[model samples]
Target: MRSHLLNDLTAEHYRRSVTEGVERVAARLATTERPFTGVTVDALAPRVERIDLDRPLHDTTAALDELEEIYLRDAVYFHHPRYLAHLNCPVVIPAVLGEAVLSAVNSSLDTWDQSAGGTLIERRLIDWTTARIGLGPAADGVFTSGGTQSNLQALLLAREESKPGRAAWEEGASLASLRILASEVSHFSVKKSAKLLGLGQDAVIPVPVDQDKRMRTVALAHELERCRQDGLTPMAVVATAGTTDFGSIDPLPEIAELCARYGVWLHVDAAYGCGLLASVRHRDRLAGIERADSVTVDYHKSFFQPVSSSAVLVRDAATLRHATYHAEYLNPRRMVEERIPNQVDKSLQTTRRFDALKLWLTLRTMGADGIGELFDEVCDLAREGWRLLAADPRFDVVVEPALSTLVFRYIPAAVTGPDRIDRANLYARKALFASGDAVVAGTKVGGRHFLKFTLLNPETTAADIAAVLDLIAGHAEQYLGESLDRAS
Candidate 1:
């Protein structure tokens, strides 16, 4: 039974297995022709379902071969030039190395006893990120699974802080008449967080945005005043640093000043634009992030690090105590009193991964300025793409992007109706994805479907975007022609 155990269970066996797997992945990535294989679930499901999990393959080599066929063969390649889908970035090499090292070590970052060096390294990275945001000396943070978790934790802190007399953590205590004010286009997580915190979805007041898709400051002020009139406590105002669809950054300076005037917690959801902290050229775009009570940063999005590398930084470190818990066996009160840097004191998760290592290695190998330059490259590419799209008569593009995303829709000469145009754009997106020619994203604006190009890859160029645009136009034309033929 001992001999039949997993290869990764032992140090020597783990090294051999991991090296082989990494080599195979590297080779596959280099040779893969398409960004996605366009393998349907129906086709792959039977093949995977046929494999009996009860029977174990004794040989690691044989298992690896089977795994490649079952998974790697159809995996979407983010590094591909035409992968203009979501906010996924082509990860840096140093971050990949860090992922490999951290997974092998399997260090749990909850307590100092479990991860001494890992704890310190994560703390140092937090400090560095805090300073980058110009958060004052008392700023502190904790690494989270991703932006969703970071946002959730930030709201949780706000909820705890908003309570009046007895702390929310205290026995027999209840919540207040708390309401979260956020842009109508802000991340869905704000509403989800509200629900999770027992505030219900209706507690989130959706403030209208301007024509540019940015939160209208006047509208926000109106909503805040309305909340007061309704006897609802405006607990927190979530200002989006970078919205998902339009990449439009809310008026953070104005939003921050409003929050200060009302004494409301300002939670900046900078998950998508936090990379600007390192951008020497575009850092000014995130002007009032320092004034935020808490800010969420997803390093994986723009910092070019792997997934699960994100943090929620607070302006006041004392606010972190809201999430603190003292476990007798894990992070005991004695250890915390002794000034031990137990990460569990701040994090919502008890057993957290050392995801900070990825960002640390990335920063160590490629300095902050280099990372910023990479982000700037993508932003530059987006501007070029925007110009190309706007100049073309075949498409209706939105306003100039604030970050590295462009929203547009194919508008053929014959398709004048709004419904027809929406169908054409949706059809084009699906057709292009199914053809495996190029992968792109779509979102609805004013109930009309629009294609989105979230350009996070610095390697993607104007030529690549131009080619993708051509493909999209071709698909849209094909769809329109088919629709006309059906009508005739």
Candidate 2:
């Protein structure tokens, strides 16, 4: 076991292990067809448990063969054209190459000495992102695990920024008086961040949204006024760049004005819409994002990169000190005083992966304009899908999509009641998933079930969406007929 370890002493063994593993993965990618096999946990758990890790196969090929049966075969393939379920995107080739290189090196980006080149690469990427965001000269950011962590860190900064003179580090009393105002349809992470930061869930005040699902500026103003009247401090105004369920972008300019007038920190969660940063045509949709005090961007969501690539950027570089802690063994005070760039000073994680390498390689190979064009393609496809859904009688399509998500419910002519229609839609979605033909998502609006099509794959076309819609209609009709038979 000691000889098999990836230490300097076992360099040859480590090289052989990695080389064989890459070959197997590449072969699997070349052959895989569908997005998912729809294997339930009950069926997969038993088979996976049969693998006896106590007895090492010793041979990489044999180990990979067994691993394929237990894990890879059932894994969801984002590259598949029909995988329109969530925010997952098909990864670019260059990013995959970066993943391979980063994994082999295993560079921990927390310290300067441990990851000398990796730290510089990550900082360069962060600088590039801040420039794209137009965060001005004082902008700074740190790569996070994902959007959730980014949101968490952004809120943490906002909390600290709201309490300037007080010792916030030792006290939870000031946090109780602080409130975070967010759109009702904003990502759930805002509320979760509040809970984790010692601000009770009740501290989150939900601002109403208009019919298009955008944050209503008038409502936000009223809420802020109410907070003032109640002697509560508005710590942060969280605006969604791309909401999860509807893909609606809030009116950022209006929200920004309100935050500015009220002197509250504005944090924009752009996890789903950050790709617009590179968009040639659709970039203006994110107007006034530059006014935000903090912003969250998830590359994995819309930048066609792999998972675990995101960053939280702040307009004021000084705000990042809130997350910094001096460790004697790691990023100590002396190192910082000497002007060393240690990433862990701004990060919540000490053992962070070199995820920025993926985005850097992607930009170099694909070019920012090329990536933007791909994002434009998906947005165009989404509008086309909206037209298709609106023209069809079976779907009660909601308002026109602001981005790449369509939220609608199946409404068969024969189905009269809203309750019955809700049941049919729910059943249809489950049946479609079980059949493994096309994977779509589901959500609820106004307490009624609605099916969703989250189109993040540029390869997916109008015809693909049409086919999935037809499948959904067929399942819904079948469910209705079955329900009628049972009633009779």
State the displacement of the C-alpha of residue 423, model 1, in Å, after optimal TM-score superposition.
1.4
What's the TM-score of every candidate structure? 0.97, 0.96
Clashing pairs for predicted structure model 1, backbone only: none
lDDT of 1 at 122: 98
Candidate 2 residue-wise lDDT, 85-158, digit = tens: 88989999999999988987899999989899999999999889999999998999999999999999999988
lDDT of 1 by residue, 192-305 (tens): 998888885578999999988899999999998988898878889999999999888999999999999888999999999988999989999999989999999999999999
Task: List runs of model 1 lying over 4 Å from the truth.
Answer: 1-10, 164-176
Clash count for candidate 1 is: 0
Query: Which stretches of candidate 2 lie above 4 Å from their native place?
Result: 7-20, 164-167, 170-172
State the weakest 10-residue window (summed lDDT) of model 2.
Answer: 164-173
Model 2 TM: 0.96
Residue pairs clashing in model 2 are: none
